[model samples]
Target chain A: MNSTAQDEITAYVFAVRAALGDLPEAQRDELLEDLTEHLTEVMADGEGPLTDRVGSPEAYAAELRGTAPFVGGFPDPPTRPNPLIELRDQVLPVLRTADVKVGGVLGYERASDFGRLLRPAWWVLRGYLAAMVVAEILDGGDQPIGLLPRIGGSDGVALILLAAGILGSIWLGRRSFRLSTWPKAVLYGTSFVLVIVALTGFTQADGYTRDSYYSNVTSYDNPYSQVEDVFVYDAQGRLVTGARLLDQNGQPIHLGNAYCYDDEGTYADAPEGVYPYCASKAPFRMPDASDAPLPSPAPSGISPSAAEPSDAPATPSPSVSPSPSK
Target chain B: MDTTQLLKGVLDLAVLAALRDEDGYGYDILRRLRTAGLGDVGDASVYGTLRRLYNGGLLTTYVVPSDEGPHRKYYSLNPAGRAELQRSGKVWQGFASTMDDLLRERGTA
Candidate 1:
């Protein structure tokens, strides 16, 4: 065979080998040798030059390969599984649905667990500090005296509690309780400073006078007013009627016939003819003749006809009087 | 009784019968089947049957190498394969004869 034809034949044999890579090496080699012999015989049978009868190398190789046995000792056909058949026959749709649900639920659980384990303490402290700084920036320098009272007030105490909580949570979360002590201490210190700063802003905003500040921090009503007569205001400066004022322990106090006035000037008065808003079951309080006689009405410069009866409830008076005139 | 099952059972018989006299590879088997007027047999089916027969030890395999091109693997029937062919041929003859008798009686009616 010509050199060119031989090269083409070699290339064809290599292609067959590549295609049959899965076959055992010995079987593949035997097949290649047999094909070479057959080609030689075909060339010898031709009358003209080997090249003339063989034609182009590509054409001859094509003919040879086309004649190769594929199954009953023929060229091996490419085998592949049908995907549709596999999906229909082998995979269970219900199982896949179950898998997806389980996977989704597991993912949510993991996320929640991570948040619980690593987020709360750090987030609370950071949020608290950031809020304080924002307040200071908003307050600017308008009122410094107002800031002092807040720093010294219950806000100061709340900051300390929050700092302690954060340190405790961190210590509990650590593998070695001693490892994070310094960082925890630093966090507490920083939290203290932030709380003080925030309280200062609170004071500057005159928050001390606000019922929320007094109720939440001072555990008392405005010092200027009786606790039972204190009223809470809404964001719009309206008296939130029926919103009972709570003590530090979150209990309600009722004083008979008393009227509570909020910042908005809206007032809630006890029922008519009632003295103070006391929690007494009595229908109405009338003068108790059984008690010691009360002092007589003043006569000098006061007209007896003009003097009006007092509306104060006959119930035992509170040890403390109503707030002095503000 | 489905066409697919019917075709699969007959395919092996047809290919073996065609190659009984001549030693031919894939294309040769296809061409000879077509020439013998069995062109309905698909080329792919014949090739697959050839592999099945070889793997079953019924067909002996050899490669004829070419100087001008790639080698070809040739298939021929062994003794056991010939015996099987003869047995299947007898069964087919009996079935055909039965069918012919049934048709003849129907035609008479």
Candidate 2:
């Protein structure tokens, strides 16, 4: 027979087999034992298309069933009651009803149609989740999972695996319909586990993001969280060392710690209530003794510029806090 | 009258009777039945009936290699099948005569 005729016979046989799907596999196969040879004969005898000659394949299978439907050659063995079959009998009708009802709500003819349309999308996602699962297994749970799968801290390995996984998944998903009993069962079980993994990964990611956002809000709420020390300065911006800070009601207010970076760069305690406790950590440079002579005899305790009138602005330090009044 | 509905009742009998004189392949048997004036007999029905008879131990099959295309599977009736044919043929004749008599009495023959 020609290739077209051959194709026609194959398609006809497939349809007939599908129509007979309700029958046991062995019976169906037995019934179609000579289907291809018979179809080829029919094609050779006729001139038009196979369907035009023999009616539709489905009708053909039905007519075949009408004459002498299959009788199993062997007496049915005493079979143990299968719980899965019972579960299927219970669930299929409910699922079919839900398919229709859900389809109506979603404005489709059937929910299964919507699901069919989303199958390719699911294939892609299934691939990503599979990659994640593989990554976890390879790492032996020693590494924390991120949104993307990384194997041995290499993005390249992860990328290659991800690509392979997605492609392989799509291939399997497309062909999964053709799988036999046990392989299909394995496929379904794997998909179920992958779905759980995807959900868990998403939940962890959400929590991590929420916690970081909360920390940002809490730290911004209080502006003085890291205010360690305060230095007073005049309108002239001169370093006002040893100046006392008083509150609104004549009460001395303490702000900075008494310990500071000393002259030798060591942390040491200074006397309490002394504003500019460390001279080596002054915020501004002062005039030399030759440039500005002190009128009063207090050069050792305070700089000559500190005794001078407030005439200039002081410099700013990123680490040191300016007086709140300033 | 649609002979297909009528053929449905006796296709098993027809298929068995076709293989009574000579063993034939599915397509050949179908052609024989068509030539015998059961023109509406479906190919699938004949094939399925042959399988059922074979499964029921009334028919036996063997494959013949052919150069034209695929190998042909030819079916032949066993002694049990021949006996069944005789029995069903008599029952059909009796039923037909009774129906004919009733029709004649009703003036619709």
Candidate 3:
């Protein structure tokens, strides 16, 4: 028998078997016997060739089983429901759009399965670009040159660092954006670290300037006579109060017997002006001069006035002053 | 109608009528239909109608094993099938008479 015919016969047998499942065993056997006998007799009685008259095994089986044969030509058999259809419908649209955008990044004219494989690199490239944007926004003002003794001028170093950071970010971004997969992740991560470093460097430079101003103010014991709280310590590290006063050059100006008092009410008498008074309470606000050239400190042990003036202002003359009467 | 077309509609009824007296297989049914001047009836049409009627609960079928060739399926009408045949036969008779009346009247007119 032709394969198709055989298949049809098998299908007919299966269908009959299915329908007969509800029948009692004896009835089922009888039905099968009857159909077989009938088919055999029909085939024998055919005047022409049995195949031509009775049809193929499949057609014969279909007719015997009461099924309609192929009317015009065989149509594809009805298919079972596909479970993936729902998921495919939902996911395909988003995937297609993403493929378009990512394909452009990868320099592809059309998206294909091969192009989709580059998605990991595309994400990394996006990350790198984001980092570069952040870094651009964060670049800040120059550092104070007065803070670092070895690095010399802060302006040059700040400008150089800023330029290097900008160039590095651009380089990393370009490199990452060119890639198609996770290798771009490395570039993105590096860009992120570079941006963080640049921000930290700017912050540290600002902090150094503030700390330098504080140090300058603290160097003077007392520029004004207004009393301030003083933390005085004895030789043994014992806390003492009422420390003496001094100038910005650290010179003691007063002489008297003054008693130092602890919060516990004990008073220890010392030479009145021996202890240095704290200057923190006297708010010595520095001039707002971010643009002014910083005044370099005088040589190690030299007094401010005695230092040779490289760019200091001229001193005022006293020859025109009036004499005071006794 | 041509004998072929006429036979198509009544083929099921004719097969049932033939099996009314005794059970027969495919070849026996074909032989009887031929003898009855229904030679124009295709062999497939008869066999197909037999199977259809059997499936439709009008005819009961049984296999008789043969020593020489394949086992033969024999068909017989049960009570329900016979009653159905009688009812359909009556309806057909009525319709045929009506058609005959109309055709004769037309002819005379």
Best by lDDT: 2
Q: Which candidate is the best by TM-score?
A: 2
Candidate 3 reaches a DockQ of 0.09
Identify the runs in model 1 with alpha carbons over 4 angstroms from their true place: A1-326, B1-5
Docking class of 1: incorrect
**Docking category of candidate 3:** incorrect
Q: Sort all candidates by TM-score, best to worst.
A: 2, 3, 1
- lDDT per residue, candidate 3, B1-109, as tens digits? 5876566556667887888889988778888999988877665567656656776788787777887567666788999779867876776788789989998989952
Q: Which stretches of candidate 3 lie over 4 Å from their true place?
A: A1-39, A43-48, A55-326
lDDT of 2 by residue, A1-326 (tens): 78988988899999999988898898888889878888898888869999998899889988877754443222224689899999999999999999999999999989999999999999999998999889888865556756667887778878988998899999999899999999999999999989887888889989988888768652575454444455555543345677665545656655567778865778888777667666566644446433553334532422324465645433232223453331
- Tens digits of per-residue lDDT, candidate 1, A121-172, equal 6555555555445444444445442322223234674465446545654554
By lDDT rank, best first, the candidates go 2, 3, 1
lDDT of 1: 0.52
Docking class of 2: acceptable
Candidate 2 chain A minimal-lDDT segment of 10 residues? A312-321
Worst 10 residues of 3 chain A by lDDT: A317-326
Instruction: Please give, for residues A106-210, the per-residue lDDT of candidate 3 as tens digits.
Output: 678546755566655544543443433443444343533332221234456545544554555456555655797777777656656656755766697788778
| Kept native contacts, fraction for each prediction | 0.02, 0.66, 0.22
**Individual DockQ of the candidates?**
0.03, 0.27, 0.09
